[model samples]
Target: MQSLSYVFPVLIMLAIGGYYVWMMQKRGQAIQNIGPAMHAFFARTGFRYDHMPPEPIEAHVHLAMQEANNWAPGNRETRYVRMYQGLPINHRQAYLYDDAGMSMSCNWSAPLPGPPRIPFHVADRSLASLGKAMREAFSNTTRCWSAKHPHAVQTGIPQIDGRFLVFGRDPNAVRWLFQQNPQLVGALLQCVEVDLWVDDRDAVFADPMQKNMNAAMGGMTGQMALGFDVAKRMELSIPVHDRMSDLLLMSVRAACQ
Candidate 1:
């Protein structure tokens, strides 16, 4: 019985180690395949990919980091950049870490030509559950800035109002922005999940990766049930550059108008 107990532990440890190795290998292979695809996609779209640091545009970098609740410096990658309709759009990837785990984000930002306007944030209602989980798991500051601002703006369109939580300091301006720009509303609806924030200086858009987070959390829970430690991180399974770019362009055009 003593010898059998010892052998059982050895087998369990070996199983755990093997699982870890397999997961890492799978992730590495995915990165290898994704890298070239990302490069090609950007080339076709006319956006420069990873050619410059984000530091030059402080507001863009700051909003992207803050949106992700990423306190730690330097995991943020400036994935792509281009000027559209006279506004520079910056796309970035950021990682946020907390006791529960880490979450990955892809965000885009464009600096407004003039002074800051009345700030507003729009979040997909479908992500309310995931947003609730994130709020509970991370710092209160991580909560959407709209929470503090506290004025809800509803578009008359039931389809949009039903699917989004839109907040702004000025209800009239918010309503007008959407009313004047049907293309902006259409762009928002076409994407799988999107969140937008408009502060004084910039308009920022994010694909919060809610679907990826839910999938990763489920996978980790399964591993935990099998006696492995939960992997405390979420990864981007694939890039959705095309959808993201369209939303960003439409947003910038609306803001500029």
Candidate 2:
């Protein structure tokens, strides 16, 4: 829909983007059109989180593990967080992960200012990589101690490395946080990458289904269970940036370094 002028200059970009869309369609073609499907996914997450005014466009994520917990699994932990665009610069992000030792979820709100201006080439391919990381992190659950908790993670990674990427609600602020703190060097070494935002509300909503599946398929119900961070569940919810500092303190410290 870009001006036809974007036609030639962005042709290659468009081709690659088209292929990405094609692949997305091939992989998980929504049963519905883009608008409805997109709205449905995030709207569902929003509804699940807080049935409040303005109907939040919720995006769910599973950072897969806690960055502070050392997320110590096997040699490599995988995870899928989120990828979004067109959100207000002040869009708020809230991590579903609690203050407990248990597994946690990542929740964020980023409604595009005017419309979805994200390029499929960038967001699409980036999403694919994030998905891969998430699956890897989840697949290797047996390797980490945190995996024993009754939750899953869906928050920002805040690393700059090639492997793991998490988008800060405010990239400038997060980048500044990194510069202000240096103790996070080790965490940053882990490649805490910050990325653009994307809606993934279904990730949070699917918690019940996943727990049920695990119980039915893996027979691990007797163990701890997973959960989504319902508004009802939030005994304490702070501004999104504060939440990020607490969760990404170490890496943020490094980025500041």
Candidate 3:
């Protein structure tokens, strides 16, 4: 009876441990199912799923996570990658990466002929999530640029809304761009956000301890080292893949011109 008591307790502990391991594996498998939905999204958008360029940004991000020891178990197993283009208009590169926690869509445009000498960023008024100070700085610094359209559309080609916040080292270039082509500004405003920086840095915040910051910084650094420009990063929440594609197409078209 005494031996049985010890044996029974050991068996119970073993059973509990086994159950915990099983639950973990099941959770991991559930994450694996996210890949198919991602695949379907690619098919719908006419992009080639899992057909990314060698050493793509997503891959680099994964490598960065590994280097920083920030990787979670099964994190690597859940990543999906795809390549796309703005067909019939722009041939520049575009791609998508969907991971366990975040999804990103990226597109590149041909370097503008004598592109504006300074970097600029524009964000939607409805979506500005930054602090009051940042908002005030952007407003004080960026003028309200307006433009008119030649087409007789239903809306009379609305003026560039006052909601956008544009910041750049060269306000004249931004003003000139808007003055020269209201249509271009209109196209850009349609995008969720735009970043036109000509530097090696990314939109990622500098704090290394923030969520995904290490991976973001390391990935951006790696891309710059590889001689590729990291132009913009638009973080997509749930079910934003289709919208991402449309906005990417519009932004690339407008910026390239």
Q: Number of the top candidate by lDDT?
A: 1
Q: Where does the lowest 10-residue lDDT sum fall in candidate 3? A: 202-211
Tens-place lDDT per residue, model 1, 136-183, is 578643433234246989867776798888878888877787887787
Winner of 1 and 2 under TM-score: 1
How many times do residue backbones clash in model 1? 2
Which candidate comes out best when scored by TM-score?
Answer: 1
Off by over 4 Å in 3: 1-28, 31-35, 46-120, 124-162, 168-173, 179-239
TM-score order of candidates, top first? 1, 3, 2
Per-residue lDDT value at 74 in model 3: 33
TM-score of each: 0.59, 0.21, 0.36
- Residue 125 of model 1: what lDDT? 76
For residue 127, model 3's alpha carbon misses the true position, in angstroms, by 10
lDDT digits (tens) for residues 178-253 of candidate 3:
4655655655554434432222222111111122322443455643543311121211221233434344343344
Candidate closer to the true structure by TM-score (higher is better), 2 or 3: 3
Pitting candidate 1 against candidate 2, the one with the higher lDDT is: 1
Model 1 regions lying over 4 Å from their true place: 1-3, 20-38, 41-79, 83-87, 96-106, 115-120, 125-144, 147-151, 207-239
